[model samples]
Target chain A: MLNLLFSLLFLLSLFCAVLTGKETETGRALLDGAGAALRFCLDITGSLCLWSALSELLAQTGLSGRLSSALRPLLRRLFPRSAREDGICEALSENLSANLLGLGNAATPAGVRAAKGMAALGEGGREELALLVVLNTASLQILPGTIAAVRASAGAASPFDIMPAVWLSSAVSVGAGLTAAFLLKKLWRCYR
Target chain B: MALLSLTPLLLLGFSCLYALALGVDAYGALLTGAKKGLTLALELLPALVILFAAVWCLRASGLSELLCRLAEPLFRFFGVPEETGLLMLIRPLSGSGALAAAGELMETYGPDSLIGRTASVMIGSSETTFYVISVYYSAAGVRRTGWAIPAALCADLACFLSAAWISRLLWA
Candidate 1:
């Protein structure tokens, strides 16, 4: 059913493109965009593979375990269900570890893992996952090294120049997103 | 040469600290979680590919421009300029498209320029609308997204306004 909907939307978009009278240019742009997306996917997949390997190695070497243990207290507060403790800790640690290294690509898998873990424990699927998505999207970090790397790769003069703004904006976005999620959740619960 | 040589040593040190803090008991758990992570990566890849292709097709077809035209007045109500309406629409569809548009604005108008600053703030703060909405709604099996769009758009507006105001206060 969802697949059908997605296909219909895609066809509609294509129709709109043709109707816009730049079918040729739009087709070219679409090709370029697809190429870019493919590249992005490849890059992200590679990063995730590396992150997974490192995470496994860290586990073999006992680092991941330690990180999870250390993060337990915080995780407990965030997810008070004792049954969900291990999953929450593991997910949070994986996310924070990747995030700290400024690997947006790698962090996504960890975030998904966290969401799945949360879902497994029956912690409100979509609503809870939406909060996580928002949190990840509005992720607060001291270093936006990934963006800087992209800037440098693109031949920017000073990749670090955007750091201050990145910090400020990320902070506000994360705060706002968390607040909204919390308020919305509370409101939903009350209304129900 | 020296910095490159030091990188491994630093990584090793961090790894050592990590192992010590996390300990041996949690190793099994970590492995389990990592496997789950891999599965998720596999699952999301195809959908992302399809969505990217579709968005690209839309852009190439010039549907984005028409959509932008339709959305212009709506964006203006939130204090975003008419020129940037295309960006708000594109940003949700494609990160690169949004960034490219923002980069062009920055290059033409200067990084600290009002439009550039606004774009920068918008980039970091706003959600990738349709993607997020669809994912969340589907995950919850929601048939009616009655208030969701309006609520999210309102949030987007707040984000835009706050970003503009804050950037102006600090940079301008």
Candidate 2:
């Protein structure tokens, strides 16, 4: 799937550039993009390491265990059988807690850990994985500090004024995403 | 904003203190977790390079802009300003790219204006859809993503529409 999308984008870009005689610009962008991605990887590594280390500490100290157990009832509803697995539940709870706290990039390592844990459960975890991806993609952040900061720097009189709108929209999106995921899964099973 | 920036510091401090209280080997655990993080980073690098290249190619070739222009009417029908067309399209593809677009829109339209507010709300609400899907799926070794992409894109659409509508309801 990624291959197909990437190929389509690559071909479309090539065709568009050729048509507009901007092939040089496209080539430069490709190289620059790759270079930037390398730099981004290096940059993110430090944060990922820090967050993952914190996650380990949280888990080892039973802090995240407490957090996960607290979150278990809700996660159980969302994840069903997968919530029964202690490993997956802990990883997921950490991810959810990070996200709720608006930890931004810090949430990814825990999310990745959760994803890996879900994958370990084999095919039965498929629906749970999809739901997890949907929840992450919906991204219900409580503070949304980054955007507010952007607005402030841009000189908005009330940068956090849009908080209500952000919250509402995020809530709506999560609902929409989950509904779509479940409906699609049902449809998929029927088709099979 | 200060509190926002201080969150990670507080989290780190509190977690470490808690770990110590629990008699956990925080240092060794950090080392072990860092190793895992490094491995995850290495695993992610190839996909990141390829995805970035694809997105950059579309952006540099003006294909993304073209798509945005073509989709402008649809966005407008959903109450999104036509000026924010590129933002709606890019928000799900790349986080930094969307931030840059949002910043540009706010600067051009004035952050107090409807377009600026809508863009800000949209950015705050939406996630990098393709990025999240790819990273999570790849990390989990899922070759076939099934309906994850479509479902997540559905969420992004809801986010965009709701952002525009709610922004207008309160600010317009």
Candidate 3:
């Protein structure tokens, strides 16, 4: 998928360059793009490191665990079938807590653990597993750290000013995702 | 609104205090986490450079602008600006790609602009649907993904559309 996208963009640019007689500029654009990306990454370094360090500290201190455990009730409601499985409940909590903390690095391992355990239930676990994935995909983090970092680096006067908007959109998206999931499951069951 | 900016600082302070109270070598943990972050940055560099370059090339050739123009009406119907068409299109496929496009959009329109805020909100609210679906399903060995992709895409669309109006309502 990524390969196709890359090739499509480049191919069109090349074709446009040919028609516009700006081949030389097109070549420079690629170099400029690389340079910009390097600088952008550099700008992101501080916040990324800071957030990761903080999340790490939280994880080590068990604060993240507490957060995850706090999610237990909600997870129970969302993944009732899988929640009854051995160790799956704990994994789901950790996954969600890590995700909420914006700890993407930590979230993946725990999420995979939950997914593996859920998948072990065979055909009966499909709906619950799907729910888990949707929850992860549309999971709402308290802080929009990465996006704020990007905005700050881009010279925004107030990078976090979009918090309310982010919160609103995230809630709407999660709601939409959950609704679709439930509706689709029902439809599939009826058809089956 | 004003307090929202303090979230990161608060989280940091709380983490540090909690770690200290727990008798966990807070300094050592910070260093370890920083190392992890450094590693993450290193891993992110190549993808960032490649995606940024590709997006830049597309933008530079004016192809993106033309495409945005073509998609403008559809986007307008959804309350999003035409400039964000590329961002929305690439968002579900790749995080780094979306970041690159968001950076470009903010740079071109200024980060305080409605379009920029909308991009930021959209990026914050949504996830890489296709990537998440693939990773989670493949890891669990689930062959038939069923309705996951459609559901996630619906969420992405909701995020994008609401981001535009929400940004405008809140900031513009």
Q: Name the candidate that leads on lDDT.
A: 3
Q: Can you write out model 2's per-residue Cα lDDT over A1-192, one digit (the tens) per residue?
A: 434656788999999999988899999999987876676567556655665665566556765446555776898888877788887877888788767655655578988988988888887787789889999999888667656656666677777677778889999999999999989998888998
- Cα error of candidate 1 at position A169, Å: 2.1
Worst 10 residues of 3 chain B by lDDT: B1-10
With a 3 Å backbone cut-off (N, CA, C), the pairs that clash in candidate 1 are A26-B60, A26-B61, A27-B60, A30-B56, A63-B19, A65-B22, A66-B21, A66-B22, A66-B23, A67-B22
User: Interface RMSD, all models, one decimal each?
Assistant: 7.8, 7.0, 1.7
C-alpha root-mean-square deviation, candidate 1: 8.1
Q: Write the per-residue lDDT of candidate 3 for residues A1-192, one digit (tens) a residue.
A: 778878888899989878777788788989998998788788877777776777778778887788886888888788888988759999989988887777777888999999999898987687888988887788587677778877887888778878778888899999999999999989888998
In model 2, what are the clashing residue pairs, if there are any?
none
Question: Per-residue lDDT tens digits of candidate 2, residues B68-138?
Answer: 78977887777777777757766787776676667556755788899999998889888999899989999
lDDT-superior candidate, 1 or 2: 2
Per-prediction fnat:
0.24, 0.77, 0.80
User: Tens digits of per-residue lDDT for model 1 on A58-131?
Assistant: 44564434554576666556555522556655776676555544444556666666665655555354455556
- The global Cα lDDT (0 to 1) of model 2 is 0.78
The residue ranges of model 3 lying beyond 4 angstroms of the native Cα positions read none
* Model 3 lDDT per residue over B88-143, tens place: 88899888778778877787788899889989998998888788888999999989
Error of 3 at A145 (Å): 1.4
**Docking verdict class for candidate 2:** acceptable
lDDT of 3 at A37: 79
Write down the TM-score of every candidate.
0.55, 0.67, 0.94
Candidates arranged by TM-score, highest first: 3, 2, 1
Tens-digit lDDT track of model 1 for B1-172: 3443233245545665666675643445445545654564465455555555665665566665666688778766665655555466566555555555554445435555666666666665554655655654554455445334544554555566666666666566
